[model samples]
Target: MNHGIEKKARIVGLFLFIGIVTGIFSIAPAIDSTNYLTEVNTNSNQVITAAIFQFTMSLIYLGIAILLYPIVKRYSQSLSIGFLSFRVIAVSLSIVGTILMLSILTLSENYVDVSSNNLLEIETLGNILKSSRDYANHVFMILALCTGNVMLYLVFIKSNLIPKWISFWGITGAVLSIVASGLVLFREIDIITVEYMVLNAPTAILELVLGIWLMLKGFDKRILKADEYENPDSCTLGTIHNG
Candidate 1:
């Protein structure tokens, strides 16, 4: 394996693991509850922690896209660019969701101090913020992520960067993720339900597996060597294979 590629692969894998862990923590149960507006003030610490985790996850998402672009672009520039674009969209939506979460927390703080005469208006605003956060975090953000994963897996399949089976699994998982997000967007299924969880399980599991695989095995050596030959001008410091 090329040392540079090996190092990059491991870094990507590490980012993936961190991103997944942070993503889970970002969904604080208190904030996700139906009575969040009433409860957020009491659970302010949890909400703040969740917001921090969410912002961290967004940074990881962008980092992964940037790191993979140079290598993936060698296989298919258009697909690589598509993957990067979708990742950026996902990150943007995730940041928006984080901001909405913090806004809700602020609203909750104000809720307790407001007079009863203003309670109804405050609750109404809270609900709107909650709904907007839901769409940003669950529906549109997930849709962009799944779309990016599809393009990424397609590149993997074409380039044999990873095993064919792993690529196929990623593609399948991405499709399932998209379906889950679509259902959420259409109001056919709510977030945090068993149905939504079941649909998203595959992609979640695939990412865990892929992260481990990349850390342990890196990209396929053959493909790295071949890509180096085909795109010498873009190649980083790596050994050339004649065989």
Candidate 2:
């Protein structure tokens, strides 16, 4: 029984759960992505609210990779690195975009007092920035779930480091999340639609539940023992390697 690895699993779960939870808060008030002008006028403080949430979420997103690396590397070193890499790009884009979002507040503030003659230019620039942030969200989401999460869940499914059912749920959730993100990206569906939420619910709930399970129950020892027989020195799966 690798108590060390057990502890790692719990920590990974904790971060994953918190990351998702914070992600929700980051986008709170559910500011409309498309209706920027209205959002600007109505939610004047939205920039501050969004920046706070995005920053918190970005840190947690990176934390998830750091926590999961050791547990995941035990199964496949390359795959673990791939997972971390995707997360890095995803989190970096999100953080940078968050900083850019700060400008929206200034833009919004100006919108309140600007001359009517410049309204067109101000609205255009504001919309452009809003669109860029939305695009970044779409790109990072696809990378994080499709590339990073897919690899992570696939490793778990193959190695039995976690329960097959939980792993399968993760895989399914990843697929569903990608589908949800795709619809938003392509304009087939809006960002804050019920259909979108329903599609993404699987992955969101998956992380929350899996995180709690890992934190509370730890890994199923029988499965971990089985994995130990297969890979004696790898930590969890890919990231942790004992000497």
Candidate 3:
């Protein structure tokens, strides 16, 4: 692989790793618990840390899209653009979720101080915030991510940028992710439940493998050479012969 392509692959892989780690850490037990309204105040630091990690993960999501766009666009401009757009949407929703988490923490602080007469009202608002956060983080955000990942894997499959099996695995995982998100949206399953986690596990595992592959091996050298030959004048391919 050329220096440019190799460098991009490594960075993308690193971002994927960071994104996954942060995403996992971003789930604050206090805010995710059933009695979050009463628990968040006691675990304020945990909630804040989770929010920070979530924000970082959102940025990493955007970064991965931006880094991959140029390469994927060479194979299919429309798919690349679609992938980038969906990732942007996912990142935006993630940030919104993070904000909602902090909002819930604030509500928790108030819930602790409120009198018994207003406890019900505070609980009601807390529920609304919690639900909104769930939808933003788990439902809508996952849908967008799945959509983008499908597009990305499609490009990879067509271009042979990575192994065919890996690309197929990505597509399958994306489909599973979409199903999970749909179930959540329809109220058939709850967030953080065993069913939901199982549905998401494939995608999470795929990402982990894909990240390691990209970091270690980068794209398929044969495909890169083929692409370079087909588009000799392309800026991205111009350096293929050099490094």
Whose TM-score is greatest here? 3
* Candidate 2 per-residue lDDT over residues 59-165, each given as its tens digit: 88888788778667767888889999988988888887786577766677788788899999988998787777777775455656467888887888777777889
**Candidate 3 per-residue lDDT over residues 146-168, each given as its tens digit:** 99999999999999989999999
Q: lDDT for model 1, please.
A: 0.90
Off by over 4 Å in 1: 236-243
- TM-score of the candidate numbered 3? 0.96
Model 3, position 53, has a per-residue lDDT of 99
Off by over 4 Å in 2: 28-30, 33-35, 41-46, 223-243
Model 3, residue 217: C-alpha shift (Å)? 0.2
lDDT of each: 0.90, 0.76, 0.91
In model 2, what lDDT does residue 230 have? 80
- Worst lDDT run of 10 residues, candidate 1, spans 234-243
- Tens-digit lDDT track of model 1 for 66-175: 88987788789999999999999999999999999999999999999999999999999999999999999998999999999999999999999899999999989888
lDDT of 3 at 222: 81
Ordering by lDDT: 3, 1, 2
- Model 2 whole-model lDDT (C-alpha atoms): 0.76
Instruction: Quote each prediction's TM-score.
Output: 0.95, 0.86, 0.96
